[model samples]
Target: MELLHKFSFRLLPPVTFNFNHTRLASLYLSTRFPVSGPAFSDPGPLFTSRRPLSSSVVSKAGWFLGLGERKKTSLPEIVKAGDPVLHEPAKEVDPGEIGSERIQNIIADMVRVMRMAPGVGLAAPQIGIPLQIIVLEDTTEYISYAPKEEIKAQDRRPFDLLLF
Candidate 1:
């Protein structure tokens, strides 16, 4: 490590933390390497991973973004549990047809319905579209409870309305 640093390479300090979140309270680590200004470009572990909230725990009446709204939004008919179409491979989206109006409309509808389903992701096959397109939701909504620095560094990526 010292040999690399003699040529001006700097190693960032490792994370030190004492987390106490549900299902993740026992971890405690302390580590450091005293190199200051940025050289290496890895911002490691801003947030700790925890077990997901169980559906049974977050029942229908549970907090929905603190609003406590109970009215369920409608979702497009999800492909049923044992549909043959689901087993069949989805068709690969044609690269040339990507920007076409029909494809755009399908993508828009996929995103809109995915939001109402409140899912973080949806594959085209899941909605009975035998195409390879997929849609994903923004992750920022789930990171509100993360640390300020973590949020700032969280790379709030935009959800592509559609992807193949």
Candidate 2:
């Protein structure tokens, strides 16, 4: 199977800001680059020859800013797009299992993994779990890394943690 990833490049017009009068504005210029991964099986091995969904520029920036530097986390490898688990319907979380240790641990792990991925959201199936659980957070920290115009265009803003 083939894995395709799309990246958008945004260009902004220059803005002059005075300390006394600060104003931020930008114009959007976007271009898409389609990155194709090497042919692989539907159910590939964990973290093998997979192209990351994020852009190389972002990755490099993160590295330069020390955002990429981190101790190894024991979280499960994020399942790739072709994984059957991702395509199938996830089982509903049992009400009785809501407060169970396993569920709590999964939620914790999900949050950790999502933050480490620096993504806004993640689903249980993305971690190879077949439960209907999702974790999401949009923090000011994450937004700060993005362009002001892009954030405004998307109406993006910090949001409290959400789990279901």
Best by TM-score: 2
Q: Which stretches of candidate 2 lie over 4 Å from their true place?
A: 1-73
TM-score of model number 2:
0.54
Question: Model 1: per-residue lDDT, tens digit, 39-125?
Answer: 335667655559665454464554455454456655556788788779999898889999999788778778877777766677877
lDDT of each: 0.67, 0.81
Highest lDDT against the true fold, candidate: 2
lDDT (Cα, tens digit) per residue for candidate 2, span 53-155: 7676777675366557667668887899899998889999999999999999999999999999989999999999999999999999999999999999999
